[model samples]
Structure formats: structure tokens, C-alpha cells
Target: MAYVTPAPLTEKSTRTDALTPLGLLTVLLGAALSSIDFFIVNVALPSMGRDLRASPATLEMVVAGYAVAYAVLLVLGGRLGDTYGRGKLFRWGVAAFGLTSLACGLAPGAWWLVGARVAQGAASALMLPQVLATIHATTRGERRAKAVALYGSVSGLGVVLGQVLGGVLVAADLAGTGWRMAFLVNVPVAVAALLCAVRAVPDSRAERPRRGDIGGTLLLGAALTALLLPLSEGRATGWPLWSVLLLAAAPLFAWAFAAVERRAENTGGSPLLPPSLLREPGVRRGLVLGLPIFIGFSGWMFVSAVTLQQGLGYGALKAGLTLVPMGLAQFAASILAPGVAARFGGRAMGVAALVHASGLVILALTALWVPWSSLGPLALAPGLAVCGLGQGVELALYYRIVLAAVPAARAGAGSGLAATVQQSCLAVGVATVGSLFLALAAGPGMREAFAIVLGVQVVGLLGLAALSLRLPRRLA
Candidate 1:
């Protein structure tokens, strides 16, 4: 099979010859915030509901709105980054995110909070693609590998940290801010990142920047919004007629978007997503595997939150603390990922998947056999640790495989698409798996529902393992 090497990175019109440590950390902060915000709000939901007097459906909006907006705008964000400067866009995104977080922190009502969260998601979309794109453009060989590994590790850690930090912030209620602290916390972090980014992060853009395709962008956004909005909000909204109509229109919009993109590509215009990029075997196959992995990852967080807090009668802090072991394991695995991948090739992901599945099985059995009242965080520690480690490894390897194949010029688009798939799957996972647990819990009991969901995820993990076989044995 013939493969094309991506265009080499264009020389930065800046003083720095390479991305500095602070530069990398600043970008990683953007990546971390994007992933963290997705799960962080989960632990803060109860507190938000109580403080705002929000209905169940309104509460769901606070979460789904962000995911929907983020998924819809990500590809465009990438295009904009390629056209504009990555450093410029990233700094603006970080600043915007901080302001939005402040808005969220100060929101006096549920609807206000939802609006702020949507804006925050938009900022995230702009910021996050640049991280991967910047790394891909500026770094090479072992440095690139290490950077990507850390990126993946941070992605996993962000999810875990969200729960822990959200729990802590709400529990602390510093200055009587209560739940508002969760969003408010981002203000300082974003400030720090922005300051470092200006000095350290090199400004880089596509060698051949293309004009944005308005038709393709609109159609793509319409397609994603139609598909994701309904899935994320339908359960809460009782699957209304609008949801059905949107769902029905989703495929049409998607097909139209693809057609528009293909036309744009053939006409020498840069489509929002260049159709040719999808032709890469690595990108296509890695995306396919990523869908299920993200689904399981987000679904596990959602289910665990409900089970630990609502089902097991644990406090928010205790529930958060329970996952500490898993987070540690995830951190360790991520740190070790580059070496492991070098040794084991793509099969490392398969091994990781098996370990993840085994952990899920253990968790399910613990839920099934142990009495609900008797089950404690410690009881689930071992399984959670193993699952986290697998997740870290899987994430690191998969990211390396997918992005390693992308050309430098198209890095923004590739990274955006990857993040889009990842976030979309996360929203879907929360909706489907969470809905399943809620429905079953309404009758069969929470313990049974919990086990059943974990069992379902175990099957998905094994499927991911199978999918890993198709990835290139070694990255480029």
C-alpha cells in the first residue's frame, strides 16, 4: 500500500525554533480543560440542581448543551486555526473559556448556566484542535511520540480529575460559592495558560491555508447538531416530535455535507473537512475504534457517579475519592505508554483492552454479588485501578496511531475530527448507557442496572480490542 508523508512543518514566524516545555504544558492545559469540563459537571449536577432549583430536564441541558455545541463546531475550529494562527486562536479560546467559566460561576438560574456552558464548549472546540495540530506541526520522531503520549495521558486524567475536583470544589464551598466553584476554578488556570502560551507557544499555520467552505461548514454543523442534540437531549425531553424530526433529518444533512465536501475538494477549495483525509487507512480505522472507546469511557464515569452517590449512598467526596486509585493507575500507565508501545506495537492496545474488559467484569461481579448497602469504594478499588490503567494505555496508543498518519498541513482538521468523534461518542455514551441504567433502575434496582451497564461496556471493550488488530503494527 502506498502512503503519503505529510508536508513538513513550516518554519514558525517566531523566535522559538521548537515548542518549549511551557508551550507544551499550556496547550495540554487546553486539551485537559476540554475533556475535564465534559465529566466535571457530572459530580456538580446535584449541587447545581439544588442551588438553582432546576428541574431534571433543565439539569440535563447544562451537560448536553456543551457537548452538542462542542461537537458541532470542532471541525470549523480546526479550519479556522489553519487559516488564522494557531497561537492566536488558542489564546483567544483560552481567554473566552475563562470568561465563560466566570459567567457559569455567576449564573443565578439554570437557563443562565446552560447558556454559559454552551459558550464554554464553543471556546473549547476552538482551543483543543490546536493542541494536537501544534504538536504535530512542530515536533518530530521521539519528541512527538512523547508529547502525544502525554496528551493522551492528560486526556484520561482530565476525566478522572473532573470528578475529584468537582467533588472537592462543591464540598469546600469556599467563600460560600458552593457549586459555582467548579466552573470558577477554570478562571485562574486559563489565565496561567494564556500567559505562558503568549511567551512560549510558537505560532504556526498550514503551509497552504485554504479558504473556508461555507456550504460545507454549514451542512456539517447542521448534520452534527441534528444527530447529537436529539441523542443528548431526547431522553430528558421525553423524545419529543422535534427530536424525531431532527433525528430523521440527520442522515440527510450528513449525506449532503459529504457531497459538498467532495465537490469542494475537487474544485480546489478547502472543504471544512477534506474528503481525501479520510482516505488514510490509519485515520479511518483509528476513528472507528475511538468511537467505542470514548463511549465506554464516558459511560463508565456517568454510571459510576450515579451508582456511588445515589445507589450506594456515598457522599460526593467519597464517591470522588473512590476513583482515586483508578486515576493513579491511569497516570502510571500513561507515563509508561511510549515505552510499552515501542515494545508491543499496536497490540499494546489489544492487551490494554483485555485488561479493561477484565476490570469491567470484576466490577460487574462486585456490583452483582455484594449487597448494595455493604458495597464501599474500597470494594471497587482494585477493579477501578485496573480499568484506569487500561484506559490510559488504550488512549495513548490510539491517539498515536491516528494522528501519526496525518499530514502537518491537515493537522488541525485531523485533530478536530478526532476530537469530534471522541466528544460525540461521549455524549452518546452518556445518553444511551445512562438512560439504560436509569430505566432499569426504575424497576430492576440500581445494582442490577449498574452491573448490566458495565457488562455491556465490557463487550464494547473487547470489540475495541478486535478493532486494534486492523491498525498499523507500528506508527510512522
Candidate 2:
């Protein structure tokens, strides 16, 4: 792929640069593709295990490999986009994603699939940051706000859609492809988006792009790997010596990463993630808020999928269908998020947290009281829908809060840093929350386990609600 240099735009000019509707759609498609892949594989895991004779440990890797790789490389990918050209990186990322998806679909064994998943995640890292960066750089004021909200909506919907689509595709067995179709489907979508992007997407780069922070990048990657790897694999692997050691070293690596970044900033070198960015009150508080939200969200999705399939003995299609109401509710709430934010200001997040907690409470009650034989998707629909609505609103508000203060020049870096936080929390959520549920299920039975997990999530939501009070009175 030839590197296309981005045309320079002044901060003044960038604020006025109108991102075409088609361009917005194209980038949003990229966002959807990346988000969907993360969750789609959850539903397909059973099929994958059956077909490939995958051990539980290997199955865990299929999910963790992509998540950890994506989380680790995201900041670097954002930096590359800012230094080079976002449009060029976006095209390359999409193409790579398509190819990697092909590799995943065609993999003949479990380990090959894990390798392919990691590569696919790397491709996703290259692509996803550009979506927010592009929106931030090319649009300003109300348009930018709306675009970000839409992106949030698309992201949340993608999570629900991925599992739903995965179930449908696995059950459909299109062309006898079975579980592979979930991945193979990305190929055509990527091609179409790639072709459309050339005409629709405008090229943009940071006004004063700096040299890559290789030292900071390496340390950040190492730190995230040390933290996430151990958490993800520990339960399945029986908490081995290596996992324990890695977990212990995670804090040390993180401290080193922080020290290196601070040093680089002091020396006037561009750190991969500028520590000063966190000094922006919006950026700092938003990230702190996002940690619990994403962790709870991803954990719930993973546990719900597993409980529905294994505990309830539901088919892939049924398990996937169960989440449709949630997806629809989230989609609706996202469309309304900007106006809600405008009206309620930061209080909207508190309201969203309360709403989310209510849904969890409802789900917990259902789990505790309902007979195992009688519980079904319908029984869970109201809670799921309510939960989705809260998630959509909270996510939209969270993105707005985090990026509101970021300068257009540093959009890629800012967006990348935010994305890294979101993705890493997502991985951790699955590792920690999913692990908790699985362990509890083994002893207390699925119903008790489900209720306990919901209770834990409700507590997290309460914390989020309290923290939202600290946000600035109004969004930028």
C-alpha cells in the first residue's frame, strides 16, 4: 500500500473541515467491524471447541490473544496514524483485518486460530483509533459531539450484534462453514469499506507530528501484557507459577512505564502517551469513570453468554437472540445521548449508572427466585433492555467527557490513550469477572453464581454513580 500523505490543515481550518456524511459512515463501519470481532468470537467458542478439539485453556486464548494484542498496540497505532496519515492507516488496517479474518476462518487447528486472532487484533488496533481521531480532527462543535455519540452507539451495538450474529452464523452453517462464517463475513465488509474510503474519507495528520516513542511503547506493551496475560490465563491454567510471577511484576512494569513517560516529557521528547494529557481534568476523570463501566460491561457480556449456553443449555442461536432487546435499546439510547447530555449535563451519567444498576438488580432477583427450568430469554428481556439503554447513554457521555478537552493536534494520541484504557479494562473484566462467575458456578450452581456476579456489578455501578458527581457541570 502506498502511503498517502495527509494534507495539512490549520487548527482553524480543521475546525471548519466538514466531514462528509459518507465519510462518517465509512469510518463508523470500521468501528463496528472492530468492535464486533471482539464479541462475535464469544458465541462461536463452543463450535470452535467442538470442531478443533480445543482445550479450555486454548479457548480462553482465542479471546485473550486478540484483546491483549489490541490493547497493547493501540497507543502505538494511534501515534502512527497521527505521524503518518489517518486515512492511509485506516485503509491498511482494514485490508489487514480482512486478510487476518480470512486466516482465522481458514485455520485448521486451535493454536492457528489463536495466532490469527492476535494478528486480527493488531489490525484492529491500527484501525480503531483513527475513527475517533478522524472525527475529532475533522469535525468540531455540535457535529463532533453528535459523531462521537454515534460512534459510542455503534460500538455498543456492535458488542450485542457480534454475539447475535455469531450465533446466527454458527447455526446457519452457511456453505457448511459453521463457526468460520462469523469471521469470514468480515472479508466482504472490509473490501466494501476500503473501496468507499478512498473517495469518502479525508486524509488528516497531526499538525506537528513527532517521532515515535519506542521506549515508552515497549514499556507500555510489556506492562499491559504482564497485567492482562496473567489475569486472563490464570484461572484456566490453575494459577501457575508463571501467571503469579507475571501478576506480581505487572505493577513494577507499570511504574517503569510511567517513569519513562514522565522522563520523556521532561526532556521534551514525545512520549507515546503524554502524561500531561491526564492533567486535563476531563481526560483524567473520564478515564477513571470508564474503567468500571467497561469492565462491568464486558464482564457481563462474557458471563451472560456462557451462562446462557452452558447453564441454560441454550443453542448458539438462542443464546445470541437473548441479547437482541439489549442491543435495540442501546441503539435507541445512543441516538438520544447528545440531547440528554445537553439537558442533564454530568448528572446524566449518574442517572445512567442508576438505571444500569436497576437492571442488574432486576436480573439478580430473577436469577435468585426464578426456577431454573422456567428461566428463558423472555424472562431476562426487560433487564437486558434497561441495561443496554444505560450502557448506551453512559458510553456516549464517557467518550464526550474524555475527548472534550483534547486538542485536534493531539487527537490521535488522546484517542489512542482512551481506547487503550477501554480495551484493557475490557480484557480485565472478562478475565476477572468471567473467572469469578465460572468459579462460583462450579460450586454454588449457575443461578447463585449469576446472582452473585450481578450483585458485584451493581456495586461497581454504584461507585460509578458516585464518581459521576465529580464530573464538570457541563460537557465541552
Candidate 3:
């Protein structure tokens, strides 16, 4: 279990090593695994429900538990990599993810599956940030730009692919594992990634590694958990006292976390998330713009799965396959993103947001007019493709601008901060937007509820459009 320590980096070294193709592939796999698992369980939920005899609430936990664990630990995971070595942390995380996936696959009951999912999420937190941090620390110029674009593509595709792959795996039911294959599939992928990472991913860490920020990390995690847990589970559990209390406690923990971060700065110690990073104009503005884009995206995915399966009576495989247009459009747009960014500069975010909003409107209209029994993949394809295109381009541009502002010396922490925003917003999207849909559907028809939720998300996208205008016109 001993890991090789990477040699110390000089302060002035602009780049550490040339990123090999194998290294890029290895890191992208880690990113894919982290993101795919988030949504993959969606299509498999019905199967899991029947197989395990789980209630509606427990099925929600199957998704929320993993997201909460992953989102909370992300900042600490990034810091650990900065202090120890990104390559070392990446290896450990991938290995742990494999083991946790096996645990999930073999789970004997609903609660055991939930526990294993939480552990899988923690492992993802350890592995994912290092992907961006490594690219930032090691690559330069066109190479860095290309790498970032590919990262965006893989990320967007991961969400789409999760749905597709989940449907395939569950339908195929390899070895008669049924829905269990959704979790089990990660085992072999993780093993291959770990081996490639050891040889290809260069070892990199912060130039001045410092002591961990235990207090700030805990406080920040507490705040996020307080906020997300209630929203994710409150409706299903009928708004219990604990859920209400947790929601009320969120703001206090957030305030305390901010204070602790400032104190660490005054004492000349490294905080898990450095406050200075947010002070940069591009970094600050980019995070704001990126937040709503991801929130709406994840929310749409969650609601779509439910609407397709429960509301419209589609099979899991059909529901998953219905997103094919979205996946294909996103893949194409992501590859074209770097060139588009080069041409449009920062205005690309505004453009992408507009495109995204337009797509959402189209989707809302489609859902409103089409009868539930009459709707099919063709009815949803146009809007899904448009949304995917905008999402792909904006995601790439946001990642480029947000991290480009950070000093390489703080790459790991900066990467963590950016990813924390991304992951946390994703969880919030499901908790708030997804929960709102579910709550409404209970009272009204599913079609009516979905249209209303899509309208709300359109407003969120409009907000993103406005925020995008404030970012710097170009990344450094």
C-alpha cells in the first residue's frame, strides 16, 4: 500500500510534466465513474424496488445517500491529494470505489445497499477532483484547453450514459444479477483505471503542502448536509421534525464555516477551501453562472426518469433510450466547445445559457400540449437535443474560465472548490427541483406537475444567462 512520493515542485515551474494520452484517458475515467454513478441508478430504480421490496422513500435514499456523501467529502478529498499526492489519492480512491461497488452489488437489504452507496460516493469524492487538479497542474496552452473540453464532454455524457447503460445492464441482467449489475459494472472499470493511473497519471501536489483544516471541513460539510438531507428526504418522510431542524441549522453552520475559514487565513494555515480563490472575478462569476446550469440539468434528468416510467408507463430501457438525442447532441457540442470558446470568448456562456433556456421552453411546451398516452421519444427529441448542445458548450466554457483564474500553487484546492459547487448544486437540484416535482405530482397529474417544474427551471436558466454576462470576456 506504499505510494511513491512525487518530487517537490518549484514555485516558478509553469508546468510539471507533459500529459500523456494514457494519463488523460486515465483521469477521464475517474471523472466518468464519479458522474455516471450519480444518475445510473435512476433507470434501475424500478428493478431495485421490485427485487428488494423497497418503499418509495428507500429508493430515493439509494440516490440521495450517495450524492450527500460525495458532495460533503469532496473538498477534504481534494485537500488530501494536495497534501499527499494526487496520483496516490487517485489510486486509493479508485480501489475503494471498486470495493464499495462490490459491497453494493452483494447487499442483502435496502439499508445495506444505501450504506454501500454512501461509501461509493466517498470514494468518488476522493478520485474526481484530482482529475481537474492534475490537468491544471500539468498541462498548458492548447493541450490544457483540449483536456478541459474532453473533461466536459465526458462529464455530460456520463449523466446521459448512466441512463443508457443502466437500462442496458438491467435488461441484460448478466448472471441473473438484475438491477445489481448497475453497481457491479463499476468493479472491472475501476480496476482497469487504477492500473492505468499508477503508470500514466503524473504525481502532483501543492508546492507548499500544509496541515489539514479539520474544523472548516467539518463545518462546511455540516452546512451542506443540513441543507441537502432535508430537501432530499423531507417530502418522502412527510416532513419529520429532524428534517425541519436540520434545514433550520443549515445557515448557522454555513456562517460558522465562513468564520473558521477566515480565521485559518489569519493564522497562516491552509483552509480546505481558500477564500481568496473566490475573490477572483472570473472564478466568482463563473461559479455563479455554472451553478444554475447544473441545477437545472440534474433536476430535469431526475424528473424525466420518473415521468417516463411512472407517469407514461414506459419501460426502463425505453425510458433510458429516449435520451439518445440528448447524448448525441451533447457529445458533438462538447467536442466543438473549445473552438467556439476561442471564437466567442466569455460571451459563450451567455450564448449557451440562451440556447439552454430556449430548449427548456420547448420541452415545457411539448409536455403541456402532448397527451400522456400519445407522447413518445420523437416528441421529446428536439428539446432534449437543444438542451444537450447548450449544456455541453457551457459546461466546457465554465470549467475553462473558473479554474483558469487560479494559481497553479493552489490547483488542488481550487479544483475542489469548483467541483464542490458543481456537485453540491447537482444534489440541490434533485432535492429542491426534483422534490418539488414529486410533491406536486402527488396532488396534481404528472403531466401538469412536470410542465410546472420545467417552467421553474426555465427561470433558473434565465438567471444563469444574466450571471454569465458578468464573467471576464476571456480566460487567462
Per-residue alpha-carbon lDDT of candidate 2 for residues 271-326, written as tens digits (9 for 90 to 100): 99899988887788889999889999989998998889888999888988999999
Ranking by lDDT: 2, 1, 3
Tens-place lDDT per residue, model 1, 413-466, is 998998898888888888888888899999989988988888899889889889
Candidates in order, TM-scores: namely: 0.96, 0.96, 0.94
Question: CA lDDT of each candidate?
Answer: 0.87, 0.89, 0.85
- Output the lDDT of residue 235, model 2: 79
Candidate 1 residues lying further than 4 Å off, grouped into runs, are: 1-17
State how far residue 153 of model 3 sits from its true place (Å).
2.0
Worst 10 residues of 2 by lDDT: 1-10
lDDT of 3 at 455: 88
Query: Which one wins by lDDT: 2 or 3?
Result: 2
Task: Please give the TM-score that candidate 1 achieves against the real structure.
Answer: 0.96
How many residue pairs of model 1 clash at the backbone? 0
lDDT of 1: 0.87
- Candidates 1 and 3 compared: the better one by lDDT is 1
Query: Which has the greatest TM-score?
Result: 1
In Å, residue 227's CA in model 2 sits off its true spot by 1.0
Model 2, position 347, has a per-residue lDDT of 88
For residues 1-476, could you state the per-residue lDDT of candidate 3 as single tens digits?
Answer: 01112235544333456568999999999999999998999888888889899998999899889988888898888888888888789899999999999999999999999999999999999999889988888887778888888898898899989999999999999989999999999999999999998888887778788897889989999998998788778877888999999999999999999888988987898777878777877678778877787888888888998898889898888998999898889889888988887887777778888897788888889988887799999999999999989988988887888877777767777788888888878877887898889889999879889989988988887787787666656554
